[model samples]
Target chain A: MSKEKIRELKKKIEALVIAIPRELEAYEFYLDLAEKSADDAPSKEMFMFLAKQELFHRDHLEKMMNDLQSQLEEELKKGK
Target chain B: MLPLKKLIVHTHHIATHFTNALFPVSAALITLYLITDKPSFETACYYSMIFGLMSIPVAYGSGFYDWRTRFQGRRTFIFDHKVVFGIIFLILASIVVIWRSYDGGIMYSVGLNKWLYVTLVYSLTGIATWLGYLGGKFI
Candidate 1:
């Protein structure tokens, strides 16, 4: 791959690095809400659902990141 | 410079422009959602906003990198406004995303919250325009 392409990949990885934490934070926020609303069964269930959704998001993002990282490494090795 | 740092310095414009482009699409999508009352439009708008939210940090990070490297970290008026407003835009976008996530029916609901959600989505376009204008001035 060309240098420009490598740079683009790096930029994408940087974005994922920033985004992953946000998904985790969202997960934590909902988890905390879920715990607090234990007595309110419906609200607690809703919060747990949201928390799971966030975890799913995080997992999806992490998969993307991993795919990108492997591609970046492969390209770097080819360049070398 | 290292490849990573070089990318940060050279790609701020690309990052910022990409982010600016996404917000308008998001704004328009949300407006269409309200007008047509279509669930798909709302879903598209939500995805656009999520994409926009993710890209903002990339833009903000690259802009900071460019400022520190190219401009010697000067605190000029335009830069100051961009930094402050950039942060504000991020916060507003996050609120809309989180609120919608918590309540899927927010857009359909009839209340101050629904209007507020719409207002926030529209405000994204205004903020993005201002940021783009300021960015142009910087160059």
Candidate 2:
């Protein structure tokens, strides 16, 4: 691949990495909402349900980052 | 830097909007139950509640799982919003269960407890909505 293409891929990987932290924050937010509703049964169940999704997204992103790192390393090796 | 900033700006703007929508979606589902007074509505609420609660539990679990399995330490942050929001949702859920029980079939019976639960549902929904705002900032 050309230098330009490799550089663009690197930028994309970096952006994906940055996004992981925000996803974590969103997950925590759902958790907080669920906790607050513990006094009420209905809301508690719902919030907990939604909170799990946030965690799923976080896991999804983390996996994406790991994959990206491996891909970047492989590409660099090809350039050698 | 400039393009990244623009992307973040756009993303935040969209997230705030999406989070805001959760309130009305939940409220509308609840209102449908209140208005129609049917068992189906009750089922709908049940589904929503179940889905909502799963989000938090799964998120926390996955976060820990990632940390332990990946050996990466990038999932910690300001947790005030999470703690408060979790408590609020729990309180609301309790009120909902009681309200569900209060009514014979679906809608609440004409009683003091009905009114009390209604008031709580409204209050807790408001809290949930605000927490969405805080979440948007962090996201």
Candidate 3:
């Protein structure tokens, strides 16, 4: 790829990296709301469940970054 | 990001939540219909389909948004009940839709006994709870 195109992709990737922590924060906030009330069994269960899912998302994102870094490294080595 | 871009992305995210909201709302309505033996059971089925259908795009889009925009380089799966649970419930909702809407209409019987419908609701509601759990973990 050309230098300009590479620059743009790099910019995009950097922006995405910034979003990871923010997304995790948002998920936590939402989870709190979900868990605040427990009028019924279902209500109690669902909110807790949603909170769990958000945590899961955080884990997934971290793993994805690690994998992508390795991939980027491999490509860099090949070019060298 | 520019304000316009952020607004667009936010709208997309909210739409996903709205779509998922359909499943529970419809499930509760279906329960009401079944208990009173109201003819409204058919209406409930229709509503369930609509709600379940909404989840497809919402789940897909919100999920896509997170994957593409937010969680691109993180270890997002270690605590990933959200991915696993969400996918399972979405699949179940789709199956229920097909089961109910077969033969092109509710009136057109697919020859399944009445008990099956009851079973479907129970199963779907149970799955919904599981989904809620996974979703909760995320928060």
Candidate 4:
């Protein structure tokens, strides 16, 4: 790929890396909400479910970040 | 006339809670599959969808009964909103599951853009969350 294409891919990877923390924050928020709602069975169950979903989102984003990083490394190697 | 005491403690309560709970699981599984491109995650997503679909009828049946008996035929705006969104959520979720199944039970592997499938599942999750929020008003 050309230098321009490589630069764009790097930028996109950087954005994805930055998003990882935000997903973690969401996970924490949902988990905390789930804990607080423990007295209310239905509400607690709902929040717990959301928390699990957020955890999955965080894990998935982490995997995506790793994949993008690998792709970025490949592009950089080609550019070099 | 349905007894007020029974309406307060309907068996459907468990079904509705289980149904609402499964929505998040479905959303999470799909999100995991989208990011990791894992076949296992995709399979889990399919299973979650199937479970969610199974729970819907029980949840809806009980919820409808409660609405009719407890609310006394008065359709409040909030209740109507919940009903409408609930139906929409069901349709959207069904489409996602059916599409994924017909596409060979793999989302990213399908010919269609992966992001589009991810977006569809995300929207379904958002709709389910909204429905839960509306339902919370009753509590």
Candidate 5:
């Protein structure tokens, strides 16, 4: 409701936004690993599995961002 | 005389090394992309996966053939572990690929939760690495 609280929420949103890309990078990296190990059947499979998992993390972060955005909007409305 | 068996073996050797060489580079690219947020690095990561995926069946096929022909009916611990891990990896890889296909190849899109995803990835990587270690011992 207060200016200070709104600023803090905005900062948290920024942090979450920054984190989303990092998660994407991780997902790509694991996929890359999986691709490389593909020749080594078992290793490749494992990496591919890991890559998928990373993708899921990135998606989760994105959902969190969406939730935070809605909350921020609600807070701003309350302040108004 | 370059027999078919020897030729297949040689092919497998090359395929294995080629695949192995790609791993660290892929890992590095991923790390770089994460830290720098560079699209160029991400491109490299995609390239690595493409090449690696192409090579998987070759390696797996050759390895499976060798196992069946050479180690048939001998359930050694190492051999068994390799087979089981290999299958697990395949299943996981399939799921990953299918998910990616549906998600339009964007990792940061909607689907599962963070904790579960992290746990699964870390666990899979650990297991894969262990499988590689066991493979090295046998090789």
Candidate 6:
């Protein structure tokens, strides 16, 4: 629980905080494309696929944030 | 100030799309390379797999995040299926990348390994489609 270690953990959590919504937005953007391309089967399928990937990315980021939070808590508890 | 998860999720829409797009593209490229026996298509397929393999962690990470926050880390059937298949997808993609990298002539060789290599590459698309379908269920 050194200061630098704590700082590094904080930085990662901060980055994940910034990333979560962007991932969600990407999910929505691809979903919109899928909807718009309904007439073209291939295009629609590709767009829908892309949208799912974005959702997956958002979920991944949230997991990272949770991990960081847990690590920080452990560090803080050790320090005290 | 907006909370991190509350901010617009539209930002940084780059690498994951490339990651998501490239697997299927690689599958298609390999299909053509098999049919035409074109070196260029095979090379393209190799590069696509490399890039696609690189971006998987990002997609995997973000998907885990969504599951935790949206679903409260609940162990539902779809999420469980996604987790299992997603890991398989990751492992399979890694195998193909390593297999091809170690032996660049894999596809050209005439053997079970070559067909397995090709079959694994094609399965990346199948897994991606399945993963996508699971993600759709979440929506």
Top-lDDT candidate index: 1
Q: Which digits, one per residue and each the tens of the lDDT, describe model 3 over residues B1-139? A: 5454345456655654554566666667667765775757657666656666775665566555655554442433322555666677677677667767663344334556455665665676666566555444433
lDDT of 6 by residue, B14-115 (tens): 444666689999999999998999989999999999998888776777666655664556554566787899899899999999989999999889989989
For model 1, how does the per-residue alpha-carbon lDDT over B113-136 read when each residue is reduced to its tens digit?
988988999998899999999877
lDDT of 5 at B120: 40
Q: After superposing candidate 3, which stretches have Cα over 4 Å from the reference?
A: A1-20, A23-80, B1-9, B77-79, B103-113, B136-139
Q: After superposition, how far is residue B103 of candidate 3 from its true place, in Å?
A: 5.4
Q: For candidate 5, write residues A1-80 as lDDT tens digits.
A: 87887777676666564456556557778887887776799988888788788778878877886787788788899988
Higher-TM-score candidate of 3 and 4: 4
Quick one: how many clashes does candidate 2 have? 56
Docking class of 5: incorrect
Looking at model 6 chain B, report the run of 10 residues with the lowest lDDT sum. Answer: B6-15
Cα lDDT of all candidates, in order?
0.83, 0.58, 0.59, 0.71, 0.62, 0.79
Specify the poorest-scoring 10-residue window by lDDT in model 5 chain A: A16-25
How would the docking of model 4 be graded? incorrect
Write down the lDDT that model 3 would get: 0.59
TM-score (chain A) of candidate 1?
Answer: 0.94
TM-score of the first chain alone, every candidate: 0.94, 0.86, 0.64, 0.86, 0.86, 0.95
Candidate 5 Cα misplacement greater than 4 A, ranges: A1-80, B108-128
Measured by DockQ, the strongest candidate is 3
Q: Residue B4, candidate 6: how far off, in angstroms?
A: 2.4
Evaluated against the true structure, the overall lDDT of model 4 is 0.71
